[model samples]
Target: MNEALWALGRGTGVVALLLLTVSVVLGIVTRSGRPLLGLPRFSVTLVHRNSSLLASVFLVIHIVSLFFDSYAQLRVVDFFVPFLGAAKPFWLGLGTLALDLMLAIIVTSLLRRWIGRRVFRVVHWFTYALWPVALAHSIGNGSDGTSVWFLALALASVVLVAVAVAWRVSANFIEFGNARKGETR
Candidate 1:
């Protein structure tokens, strides 16, 4: 029935949001400089990377299900090209841009060996770009954007990314401090 399909679509969206939240948390907790308080390095890194990949998988499912569900009115074009959605073209265009960025990051990651570390590292910088793009997509076009769960997830992602960035900055500061101390010695 139509109702059943709508419920399924909503459920899929919810799952995708949850997965994205987990991915962001894992990423923040496993950063080289700010790993989770007591967890072993290898374990945290494993979980973080795998969780991110899982989130990406869920994202693919979420996008695909949009086409199947009659309620969302998602077009294939809206997934690839920006500003083409029948509803709120600008917001949906953000989703399309996010998808493209994700695709580029995924492809480069999978081909890292062939691409070589220097080139791969350059492309990897785009991963940061993907997060903000994805955040905008979820906030701007997500159907459940106002729901408590959605808001929590969005805020968590923002906080996690913020913390990771802060950790990195603090690390640089510490290195600089140590270098100065060494020079004084």
Candidate 2:
């Protein structure tokens, strides 16, 4: 039973990270006019939304499995509060923070239409922080974090986020430059 829970925890955590990575990348890439995978422009948003939801589900499963796993020795409060767990509090706290941020993003997104676009966009930007915090948690507490398989997956996620973030930031800078030139002219 303990072994099963531990395995489930690790498996779900990795899967969640993968899904989150894809969602983050798509969120950035879809802002551009170019269609992805020859799909309709609208399809990108659909995929991003679905991927994020799936990630959230997997994250919940990971947390639950770890909480039950005797190996983890996680208390209920530790899951909610940051740094309260016996299983490496600092590392566990990162996961807690990530979860909190993700929940905030999810809530704001759901209320987006009702609240307003500006608020939603601001909250959504929190994802930039969420990905790294979650990654740190995995590396610090993960049993297989340093393994070849995990490293390969982590490398892929890092590359995806890095490329997407760079592209997104540069795109904004270029637009700003163009706008500034227009203003001067």
Candidate 3:
């Protein structure tokens, strides 16, 4: 029973991380205005939006399972406030902070239309920061952090996000270069 709960918590946490990784990569790819994975623009955007929500759902399950797990000893307070836990304070705090950042992102995204596109764009940029924080937390705090499968997932996520970011940066530079050429002409 306890073992099952522990497994559930760990599994959900991993799933959430993967989903979040995909969401972030998709976001960067979508914003780059380049064709991604042979998918159309609408499909890419839809996948990005849906994956984020699914990631949030899995994160909730992870937290709830850990909160209830006798071994984890996580209090509700520890879930929201950073660095107050008895176990793995620093890493757990990072996780808490990541969650807080995601919460802000989620809320602002929901109200994006009302908040205006400019503000939404600014807030959406936080996903890049959130990804690294969440990654650090997963690596530092996960019990299976060193397991082969976990390591593989982590490595793949890092590569995917790195590639997406690099692609976006290169695209921006190309656009800038073209604009400079136009200005000279």
Tell me the spans in candidate 2 whose CA falls farther than 4 Å from its real position.
171-185
Per-residue lDDT of candidate 2, residues 87-183 (tens digit): 6899999999999999999999999989899999899989999999999888888898888988888988999889877776663544355664566
- Order candidates by lDDT, high to low: 3, 2, 1
TM-score of 1: 0.81
Q: For model 1, where is the 10-residue window of minimal lDDT? A: 171-180
Flag the better candidate by lDDT, 2 or 3. 3
Give me candidate 3's TM-score against the actual structure. Answer: 0.92
What residue runs in model 3 are displaced by over 4 Å at the alpha carbon?
172-185
Best by TM-score: 3
lDDT of 3: 0.90
lDDT of each: 0.71, 0.87, 0.90
Considering every candidate listed, which one attains the maximal lDDT? 3
lDDT of 1 by residue, 25-141 (tens): 565555544446787867777886787787787777778777777777888888889889888888778878877877877788799989888887677667677767767777777
Clashes of each: 0, 0, 0
84: Cα error in model 1, Å: 1.0
Q: By summed lDDT, which 10 consecutive residues of candidate 2 come out lowest? A: 171-180
Q: Backbone clash tally for model 2?
A: 0
